[model samples]
Target chain A: MSTTEPKRRGRRPNGADTKEALLTAAREVFAEQGYDAATVRAIASSAGVDPAMVNHWFGGKEGLFTAAVQIPINPAEIVREVLEGPREQIGERIIRRFVTVWDGVGGGQFAALIRSVAGNEQAVTMLREFVQNVLFNRLVKVLGVDHPEMRVALCGSQLIGLGMARYVVRIDPLASADADAVAATIGPNLQHYLTGDLQLLA
Target chain B: MSTTEPKRRGRRPNGADTKEALLTAAREVFAEQGYDAATVRAIASSAGVDPAMVNHWFGGKEGLFTAAVQIPINPAEIVREVLEGPREQIGERIIRRFVTVWDGVGGGQFAALIRSVAGNEQAVTMLREFVQNVLFNRLVKVLGVDHPEMRVALCGSQLIGLGMARYVVRIDPLASADADAVAATIGPNLQHYLTGDLQLLA
Candidate 1:
């Protein structure tokens, strides 16, 4: 060690350094043991920091995962943008927004999430939570529809399906089709899921 | 070698025996080397039979894969059943049939196919061909709709997405929902994709 450098022992590292350390540790632990088996205490210990640091920096495990996974876009902003339009066009707006965002980021995060979901319990949980909490719940509340849970799930199925075919699976025509074309084709389906009759039992 | 059985080297094996051997060898080779790298010659050698046997039995690599994978149900039959019903209710029938088939098989084949699709090129190709040829093409031909390709793709996305969510990823509610409930919820969306306006070129 350089003599000029400050002593590291017993001194609290800067917040940025601690946070980075925690993220690195979390990624490693999650990869190794998966989400269910990974513990906050273990992650903190691996980072050479106190367990409380995790709660302090991120509210809890879900918050920590949100940080570590780093889903490229803020879902809240997307939701807000979609809701700004006429309620009838909400489905079209949502589909367009989805295509634009995924295409904008080159679908790296979504691809990674989908690929990891098959074998990883943590990934599956993260996906379910993200869809239910971030995307579906908010829309369901805005729509104020009956069977909100089923509405959200149906919507999720369509959007997630679009993502899978166009991005992950790279199915032809859909994969290469322009965003407008895709939106136009898929928008109505999303509309039906969002506000149309699901034919569910009341 | 069984003492009662004649020496096996020079004789061309029986058709059933040779076909079975080729299928077993093809499965191992495909799993180990993936579809792109697994050659017919390699499979034949592994089966201890002449390379010509693959062509004689299954036509080629694609046919061999179809035999090995064995997707539990026939696509043609499902298409026929869906088509036999009234044109307006085709979507509901299709969704019901889909839920019934996947639920009947216990989702093993669907889960396996979805999971394998990510890393395996051969699996992706096979999936594309299966969807495009067996499912989509037949449906499009029956519907004789405008933008048949897009229609097929949109339908594929929803079904594939539902499978991923319910079986592969096991998202709650949708995953646990009975076949009837799932069909009721997702049926209309599928119907829309099948015969409803897609808003293409607008």
Candidate 2:
């Protein structure tokens, strides 16, 4: 049988639009009902699409979540930017990039994210994925370091703790202080966490 | 002042028992409904006492919360124990104590406490009080070192982060890890955080 080549392969005019619509709906549903509580049918209904479409496009809720929360910054790209120059200075870049994301999304997004994690099981899974895959995994690979997992987890904890105190809990001074000010205060410790001389103590 | 002194001096016979009962009720309510949602009336009702009893006994809700979550271990006692021995070994003792409290409480109490922090405003306030007054305040006083407040806060962040990862999220290895093992892994860093040389980088 003679086969014809596909008409247009690069970009589907409507595909991006549908994906965005579904993602927005999925985020709201997950936020409201949590992971176990939100259903595919509910998400599809909210998106004004057939339930079968979600399965066809996203594979399932897990896939939809991964797609929805994917940060615009590419992990490989971030690793390159962060790891360039002497390893000693990497911590500042890391902190600055993290701060940029927080400022770009604003406090409300972080609050919503924290709420989702507290309220929903799926949200925790998603959070673990975002931290482990999108951020920590790449950083570990780039650092090519020992205790990579613990180091990544430790960095995550430090950053998250700072975020919780500054944004979620709204602790005095930290909450009210300028973003650059905080980055200056906490950045070096984080850098040390990533590539510091821990073996010296050992 | 003289007239009031007599009233204060002539205490009720069962005052201690009643106060204990109220505290028990307050803990249950605070654990279940968190601080803000757990009304004084409800706690009193649970305790089978009038709402006025809470006022008569603990001053108000905030005071009641202080009593509810108070740990028996004194920070002064802890600092004394640490400082009594070699400064280098203080880290191990500190880590041991932390593990003891976390294990003693069982995961459920901590889960309830964390859930309360997530769900209730009053719980957050009460938690802040407990962290600030009973925990951090004591640590700061006993450490008797420079930047005591910041040091204490940072130490708290590490401990709380460890708890969140271990108990709430149940991160493996660490979650099921033996108490002593965990103490060894995290203790030295925490020790450095508490009393090590942390002069600002040039």
Candidate 3:
């Protein structure tokens, strides 16, 4: 019984350790070589693990990236919260939510992501996926607006720009302004992107 | 008399050559070490000119940078164009102007500026000053809106964000979308930031 118990414990811990090693290796590889240049084999080799382990654990490079740079907040939950609110105030609520999460909880991860984005194609891809696939796609679907992609892109640009100014570039007034104040000033524009007329070409 | 004239010509050409040398050296240094890490002395030495020449021609490193990365388009001219139109269409015109400048004429310089901004504080400072002092302050004054700074900042965020996505990050749809389409979609939001009612707190 004792021997069996030890073996069971060893199996689980080994899996956890391999996952951790892959994550650490992946971050270093991504930082050094960037997203496009980083390969699964290299990440695995750096971790001293078999290349297949990456697929087994992360499914692929994109999944591995998502795990590596995961924000603390869940996109689905934010989508639900924004969608649950009064439809008219959805824009205000969404901007306020972004300011809160990005300022406090997700600030560090976001900064790291934004910093990596300048010269790194992978970082840019990761950012695009998170904004497009994770956040805006779901929101746009819920809104059922015309030219949903364009609408989402516009909203994404504004929010990402707000993040860039406030955090990355540290533009003044905008950077130091109170969160609610920013939301109030910027929220209407977001709302316009969401439910307002986009006037996209056919 | 011939000897005296030759010496005079020699002195003027030397001065112009030194100034030109400093400008070339400054661009290389700024690109390699970024704006903050680069020094006037280093730029001068790289150019094989006396360090004081940097101050003589450019006034300082900041002036040198302004000269190096100067955007071809005049912000004041764009502001005039946007404001001179029918008040209702101001947003559309402004966004159209931004898309045109960034996509074509000023694309390369803007890309360099935005790319450097990630790790370079000096680039950020330059961008902030250009947006605040040169562009938005004048536009806000023309509009005479309340919370003028905030309004300008908001406008700056959106425009900067569009530039980042389309040029730097290269996000699709927004990146590839026609300028007129983008302007139509994003224009109203700018209009809102400019002349629309902003629900700012007291």
Candidate 4:
């Protein structure tokens, strides 16, 4: 039993070591190259792990990205899922998913993430690139919208603001409000940003 | 002249002493009673200074609140000014003023404020109350909106998100974009929150 316990502990640490190594390497690569440009093979090579280990540990590049970035949700997966639905309802879907996922984690992690981003320059850069390019930008391109840069910024602002108000600041009504209600309240504005006519600011 | 230096130094320290005392007391008082309820007399009394010192040192209750909160601009003054304009243009006015005041102070202060809010529970509560009650909630009431709570939250989210994107994270295009352009791009959305029909979340 003692011998088997040692082996069991040894195997888990070995697995954990690989995952740690991958996360370390992935943060550097993703911040430097962004989500679309950074690849599984490159990250694995950087971590000195087998290419398959990316899948084994993080399920894929998206999961790895989520872990490395320290954001609890799989933003890539959420984006893909959010886009799969009717374009008109995308705003509601994003808000609902956001509230559900963050609330699921007890919402404190959102504040922690904000603290990390506020204090760390690297985290800020990674999140900035992720919010602008990896997430909202991708959504903008898929929609084939004009002024993609502005749209992404607008969307980023509202979404991040909603998270701050509800989770971090715990603003009443909005803070205590349910996900469906939040979606209904803020969804239309988000939809307007996504699909409505916006005057070009530049 | 050399002997007179003692008197000059004595007078400046006396002035600074009053200012310092007021600020210390104001922080505690404002945090405790909020903007409207916390009177200049109370803060001055708490600091062991005369009520006139509130205006003489910091301009008035509004200015004292500004200094006490550590926010660079007078939110009360800004609110008063923004409301003086046509209601339809209020959103644009707000974006323009927000960008101008923060930008005037070089915008870095916004990040500093965020860092403070994220790390300190007291700062979080103060800001939450300020944004919801002192700022947006007042606006909702002026407009006589149906769902005042939701409107305030929606507006709070977008405005804070805009600040985070433009000033803190420094997200592209949005970050570098000119204020007029930003106002035009984002104003309509703000107007909707201020005056538009929003489906209630509760």
Candidate 5:
């Protein structure tokens, strides 16, 4: 638009277009097939681009999924980091990681995410997938916990609740609390949800 | 104005108008003054009605607040019931109560509340007041819990999260689980937040 502006750099103009096409294709494929069955190759093919573009643009399925949903964090990285820690401390790690990521970008990202989830069925589906298929799925598989489904659901509830409290509703002293404080208060309960007993739950 | 309709019942003529006026006035007063400081008399006066109309229509202050916010449950009765229970079992009572109220109305009300909360700042403020000033405020006052504010917030987070999972997202088997199962599963965690040692929360 600006005639005096320098020419667009190497492959830069169409790159965004390609990425957008892939994002659109990814949404359609993922919506139809969900996280487990929706393959990167299918998404690429649907986008009319080479399969390698999936890796080149998004680094993998999880990244592409995160991009498609506009989630602020990468599921692959978060899951990997969450699992890398000791079993007993997993909850604290989760709370810490959550606070750090959301706080790093400021709170607007999570508020936006919640608003989207509240308003959009597709967003709700994406969130459930991110929780069940992406994040907790790996954790429960590694832990070999009883009532794995319940564990995942419980974990999702607490973490999402934590996000709502801190970012969306801005409740304090929880909202103003530092990461360690949040972990200390909420982590043990999260740990219980993750690996605790359930005789009564029956 | 249907001629076929029965004579609209006794005092039915402007009763609906009075209730609507009270609701509108309650919203403005609660919005400006919050749950604790707001008065039923002020709300009734703002609606240009007798002070007794507040009690006649909405039961009391909590009823008026819930009505103004279009919340499905009565916070006064809930707070009363939650407080009437033994201290140790308060958490189970909470989970059970929450599930029953939402389930009784079907899941639509909680989902609608979340949607409203997500979309409206005034809704957010009202919810915060409902949590801090109405529900947890009394519980904390009675139980004398440490870090009362944090406990209130943590409770808010988990309960709201549970509502989202069970009703909005329908993340089973927690979503499909009966009230007893949910109470058994999530109750202790709530108890911990309610009256457990919060030493590390500092």
Candidate 6:
């Protein structure tokens, strides 16, 4: 009884497949209902798994969410690349690299995620976590700039804004415009955010 | 028979009040269901009037939407203010003035309106019209930059990003932070967007 019950209690029938199913289900649920309103039961139902499995695999809803939408980007990787080049060209590289990621993702996922923030509470929180923990934290470590954290936050605002125009709201001409053109236009401002002497009164 | 039906064709029974009620209902319905999903009949019902009243007053759904969320600002008035000041300081003034409007509105109406774009096709189209026709068109005149239209669009990206951070997502210290503080922090970047050296390469 002890052995059989313990085995049944902890193990998922199809462990890896269950986890994948949960993630897929979580993405759909999170995207649809947003972070706050989405429930574990709904996600479990969507995945056809036991609610206990969610806790066993991912701790809880937040952990499951982290696993679902958390992009595995190492900011150090980005910083390393940006800093490896000449310091003066950092802005161009930074902007170009950012445009590359959004462009590479085909704009739909990122755009959906960004546009979803306005209506859903959980989406907004998850979005902040993704930006703060995944993106901004990484940028601060790599740049080695003075006031790097503030600089990273500021730079993030620029990129987020660019995404809104280019993808979410799809402001024409700019929305449909070429990637290189955006990089060239916005790169410098982001660079300034990272290293410029932006005095408060100035 | 003609006299019996005459009142139906005459000026709306209680024209001004009916118009105001329609505008109020339109904003809520448009905010909730968006432009396409929101029916003239529904708006009329919400306003306790006839559907024909919408067509009579605003010409159609587009006009009704225009009247609903439209923030009445004279571009000429704003542009004249910018042109009067030192051209270089135009960016800062514009940023400050823009913030004042958002603050005056207290973010609820605009935030709800902005948030409603999700999962709705009609709302998206209406948002595009509002931004391009109403918001950006006005900003372009005031920018007075080398490429006035392009600069205005870029500035719009910057401003919207600030709004997302400050109001929508309410990110960090910026969210709870004072209006003056935000203006001081982000105004210059916007200022630069308006009048900075476009040649500065990243």
Q: What DockQ do you compute for every candidate structure?
A: 0.48, 0.25, 0.50, 0.57, 0.51, 0.38
Which sections of candidate 3 miss by over 4 Å? A1-65, A106-108, B1-56, B59-61, B106-108
Q: Write the per-residue lDDT of candidate 6 for residues B151-185, one digit (tens) a residue.
A: 65677677767767666766665555565656666
Task: Considering the two chains of model 6, state its CAPRI-style docking category.
Answer: acceptable
Q: For residues B71-178, what per-residue lDDT tens digits would candidate 4 score against the true structure?
A: 555767877888996889999999988888878767766776676677666678768878887887777777787878877877888888999999878887889988
Show pairs that collide, candidate 3.
none
CA displacement after TM-score superposition, residue A172 of candidate 3 (Å): 3.6
lDDT agreement of model 5 with the native: 0.81
True contacts kept of each: 0.57, 0.11, 0.60, 0.88, 0.75, 0.34
Model 3 CA lDDT for position A147: 77
DockQ of candidate 2 is 0.25
Query: Candidates' TM-scores?
Result: 0.74, 0.72, 0.77, 0.71, 0.72, 0.77
Model 1 chain B weakest 10-residue run by lDDT: B4-13
What lDDT tens digits, residue by residue, belong to model 3 across residues B82-124?
8886998888898888888767643545556665666566777
* lDDT, candidate 1, B118-144, per-residue tens: 545667777877777777789889788
How many times do residue backbones clash in model 4?
Answer: 0
lDDT of 3 by residue, A1-202 (tens): 3545565566687888999999988877875655666799999999999999899889988788788876445888999998886787888888888888877743544555665676566667877888888888998898888878777778878887998878766666888887788878787778888998777767
- Evaluate residue A22 in candidate 4 and report its C-alpha lDDT on the 0 to 100 scale: 96
Q: Residue B111: error of model 2 in Å? A: 2.9
* Tens-digit lDDT string for candidate 4 (A97-177): 989988986786677567666655666776787788778877888889887887788888888898899888888788999
Best by DockQ: 4
> For candidate 3, what is the interface RMSD?
1.5
Greater-lDDT candidate between 3 and 6: 3
Off by over 4 Å in 4: A1-71, B1-71
Error of 5 at A150 (Å): 0.4
Worst window of 10 by summed lDDT in candidate 4 chain B: B29-38
Instruction: Provide the overall lDDT of each model, using Cα atoms, as 2-decimal numbers.
Output: 0.77, 0.67, 0.78, 0.79, 0.81, 0.69
Cα lDDT tens digits, model 5, A58-171, are 888877877876555687788788888588989889989999888976876677667666756667887888888888888898889988988999999999889988988888
Interface RMSD of candidate 4, in Å, is 1.2
